[model samples]
Target: MLNIADTLYRWCREARPFALATVIEVSGSAPLPPGTALAVDTDGNAVGSISGGCVEGAVYELCEQVLESDETPVRASFGYSDDDAFAVGLTCGGELTVLVQRIDPTDQPHLANTLEQASDGVPLSVAQVVDGPPRLVGRTLSVLGGGSAYDGTLGSRRTDHTVADRVRALLRAGRTARVEVGGDADTCPEKLTLLVHTQAPQPRMLIFGAVDFAAALSQAGHFLGYRVTVCDARPVFATAERFPHADEVVADWPHRYLESAEVDARTVICVLTHDAKFDIPLLRSALGLPVGYVGAMGSRRTHEHRLERLREAGVPAEHLARLRSPIGLDLGAHTAEETAISITAEIIAHTNRGTGLPLSRVPGPIHGRVPADEAPAPSELLAV
Candidate 1:
C-alpha cells in the first residue's frame, strides 16, 4: 500500500471509487510481508500486488466483488490446502490472510489523507480494526510519531487510546505488526485484531563517486526505492547532469560530506573513489558509522594497501573487517552497467543477510518474510 500511495492519492483526488486488498497476516512461506496491498479501481485498473503473481487473479476477483456489491471489509484466507489445491492456492506453498475493502474519498476521508501523507514520505501508520464487531471491521485510526496528533477513531475511546500507543511502538520499531487489543485488562473482553501498516521514510544510498558505474548504480538504487545521493570532490564529475538518477549530487569531499549527512542503520555507503587520499579518510568515517553497508571498489593489491593504511590510521581490525574491498559479487562483469548490477547485488545481499548463492542451490523456503534489519520493498514488489 505504501508503494501505491501516489496512485491511490491520485484516484482519491479524482473522486474515483476503488477496492483495496491488503495482506494483514501470513503464515508459512509467503512472498510478501504483512502490509503489502493490491488496489482495483471501478474501471478494472489495478496497481500493486499482495502475493507476487500467485493469487493475484483470485484477489482481483475479490476486489471486483467488493466494488460491485459495495461490501464491507472481508477477510479471506488462501493457502495450499488439498481441498482447494486447484483453486486459489499459493504456488510457493504458503498462506496469506487478505482484507478487502471498498474505499472512496468521500467516505474514507481519513484514509485519503493518510495516503497523501504516505506518498509525501511522511512517517506514519494506519491502524485498522481487521476483526471485531461487525461495525468496526474497517474502522481506522492514523497516528504520527510518538505525539498525540491523531485522526479518526475506533468505536471506543479506550480502544483508540490503547491502539494508538501500540501503533507508536511499531512505528518506532519500523515494523508492520498485527496486534490484539481489547482483551482482559485493556478494554472489552472481546478481543479486537488491528493491523498496523507503517510507512517509513525511504532509506538512503550514498555513493561517494560520480563515475559511469556510479551513474548506473544510482539508477539501480532509485529503482530499489532508495534516496540515492552521489558525492565527489570534483565539481565537474559530481554535477546533477551527469548523475540524473541521484536524488542529490554534491561536490564535496567524501569524508566531510558524510560527516555532516544524516545517516542511519538503513543507509548504505559505496566508496568508488579509488585514490588513497580520498578512500582512506572517507572509509575511516563510514566504517565507524551505523550504516548497513560499506563497500570500496579496488583490485586485490589496492585492497591490501588500503587495509594497511586503515590499520595504521588507528582503525580497529573489526572495523576494517566491515569494509568490503574488491567490492561487488563475482559476476565477472566488465561493462559499467554490469558492474553496477554486481555492486547492487552485493548491497542487497548484505542488507538481507543473504549468502549470495544461486537461488536454485539454496534450500528451504524460496520466499520468506524480510528480516527486521533489511530494507523493506514497496508493496508492489517482492522484497527478494
Candidate 2:
C-alpha cells in the first residue's frame, strides 16, 4: 500500500488538487477503524484504504467530486441496505462514514509537514477543519521531538494548548480520540478530530531470560510485533546460537539493565529469571517505576516468599499487585513451547482485555484472514 501521508505531501508539492477521505466513524465489522485514512487526487490515483476494497471505488468517486467542488468538508455515510438497489453497500453489514475535503494548500503547510513526518513513520495527528474557525479551520498540530509543538492553531490558544497536551499523551500510547471542547467556556462549537499517531515504531519487549522457555516466549512475543530483547546474566546461556530468533541477547544483570534504562508504559519488562537472587532486585527496580507489564515466573510458594520479601523491603501492597505472579493464562501448559503460548496469550489478553472467546461467538462480520504468503516478512532477530 502507498504511504497515505507521503502521497498527500507529494501531491501538494506538485500543485495537484486532492481530497483526503478518512473513515471518521465505524460500526459492526468495519474493514477499517476510525483513524484509517485514504488520499485521492484528481487523476484517480489514491493511497491508503478506508475499506477492504468494498467501499474504496465508491469513496473514490466522492473524493473526485469533492476535489472538483467549492463546497467545504462534508460528512457522508455508506452502509449495507436490503433495498434491492444501492449495489455498493457493505456486504458485511457494516457502516462507515467518510469525511472528504479538499486540502487547503495555504492553510495546510503545517498539516503537510506533519503528514510528511508521519510519512517518515513518525505518527502524528492532523486536525483540520471538518467545519470550524477559518484560521483554526484546516490547521495541523504535530507532537514531535518529544514535546507538544504545532505549526498551526485552532484559533483559540486556550483550547489549542489543552488539546495538544492531552492529545500528545494519548498519542504516545498510540490512541485516537474525537474531542468536543467549549461546552460552557465559549460561544462557538468546536469539533476537533484528534488522531494520535504512533510516532515511533512498535513497543520493545525486553525478555531477561535466555532459557528454553525464553526462546519460545520471545518467538511468541515477536509474532505480536514487539522488538524482543532476550538478556541473561549468565554469558554461557546468553548466546546467539541458542536463541537465534531473539532480537537482542545481552549478558548483563537484569537489575542493572532495568535500573539505568528509560522505561515507560509501552515497554514490557518480563522477568523470567526464576532465580530469586536475580528476580528480587529486578522486581525491586521495576516496581518502583510505571513499566507496562512486570510478570515473574514462579510457583505459589515462590510468589509467597517473594511477597514477604517485597513487604519487608517496604514495597506497598498496591504496587505489588502490579506484578503478575505465575505469569500467563491458566492453559495448563506442560512443555516450554506450550507455556510460551500461554504467556503470550496472557499478554494479548492484558493488552486488549479480550474475553478470550471464538470470533464466531461475537456478532460481527468475518474478515478474511491474511494469508501466510502475504504476511509481512519476519525481521531478522539475530541482532537488535
Candidate 3:
C-alpha cells in the first residue's frame, strides 16, 4: 500500500514477505475512504490502517491470517453490528470490503518499484486485480504519468491495454477508485475488478503576498497538506524568517513568478497584495488557469476597482466571474490570523460545494461521499 510504502518497501527489501489489506469498497459513513491499507510483516509487526482506529485490530489479524494462508488473496467484510459490542465492526454504521493478499517483492518486483517511485514522489498509479479471474488475482498494472510506458501486466496485452487506459484517466484526476473492466476471453475473466491507487505530488498553494495574512494562511495551507509558496517583490519582507511555514518564499514580481511556476488543476492561488500595480497583472494570469481556487483579499470598494482594472487588461467576463474578490465567506474576521481561517474555510467550502451556512440549516446526511473530483485526499497522505 502506498500509505505505508516506505515501511513496506523496507520490509520487502529485507526479504520479509507481508500481507497487504486494502479497503476496496465502502457503504454508509466511513472515516477513511477506500484504498486505505494496512500491512503486516511476518514478525507480528503492522503498519498503516484500514480504518482510523475502529477496525485496525481486526484488520491487523486479517493480515496475519493472509500471511499464514496459501498465499491466496481473500476478501474480508466488516460492517456495523448493533447486536454485539465485541464484534469486529465499524462504529460509524459503515461497511467496508477489504482485500487481503501476500506479496514476495523479490518475485514480484513491480510492487517494489511502485513503492520506490511513491517514496521518491513520482506521479503514478498502481492498479491491482482483486476480483474476476482467479488466476489473475493479485496481478498488477502500474503506469507512470507524462506519457510514459507502463510496467507489469494483467496476464495479457489486451487486459493490460484496457486497464492502463482507464488508469490514465484516474491518474490524471489523481483519484483512488474501484472499477470493473469487461471480459477478455484469453488471459482474462468475465469482469476483472481492481483498486487503482494514484500517487502524485502535493497540491500547490500559491500565496501572493508576504504580509501577516499570507504567513498565517501559509500555516493553514501547510496543515491542510498543500505545498505553500509565498511570493512578493520586497525581498526584505519575503524572507524565510517572515514566512517560516511557507515551503518557499520568492522575491519576484508576482505575475512574473506565477508564469514560471508549475501548476495544475489542483493548485490554489491566493492574492493578498491589495495593491493594483501587483494585483492587476497577477490576477490576469491566475484567473485564466484551470486551478482549483482563485481568491483575492480586498474590501468591497477595492474589489470593484480591481474588476475595472482586470477588464481594462482584456480579461474575459467569464474569467472575471471566477475570481472570489473580497475573498472568504463573511466570518466577521478582523485580525490577519482570523482572516486566514476565513479564507481557508472559503477554499474548502468552494471545493466541497458548501453554501457557507450552518450544517444544521442544511439538509442531508452529515457525512456524505463526494466524487473524486470534488474531494481528493492527498495521494501521499500517511494513514498511520
Instruction: Give Cα distance to truth, residue 166, candidate 1, Å.
Output: 0.6
- Give per-candidate clash totals: 0, 2, 0
lDDT computed for candidate 1: 0.83
Candidate 2 TM-score versus the reference:
0.55
Best by TM-score: 3
TM-score for each prediction?
Answer: 0.53, 0.55, 0.56
Candidate 3: minimum summed lDDT over ten consecutive residues — where? 375-384
Q: Can you write out model 2's per-residue Cα lDDT over 205-310, one digit (the tens) per residue?
A: 8888878889998888777767778888999999988887777788999988877776665577787877878888888888878766788898989999998888
What is the C-alpha lDDT profile of model 1 across 237-344, one tens digit per residue? 999999989999999999999999998766789998899999999999999998878999999999999999999999998999899879899999998889889998
Candidate 1 error regions (>4 Å): 81-86, 145-148, 184-190, 201-259, 263-384
- Would you list the clashing residue pairs of candidate 1? none
Candidates 1 and 3, the one with greater lDDT = 1
- In angstroms, the error of model 2 at 317 is 32
The worst-scoring run of ten residues by lDDT in candidate 1 lies at: 375-384
Clashing pairs in 2: 123-199, 129-138
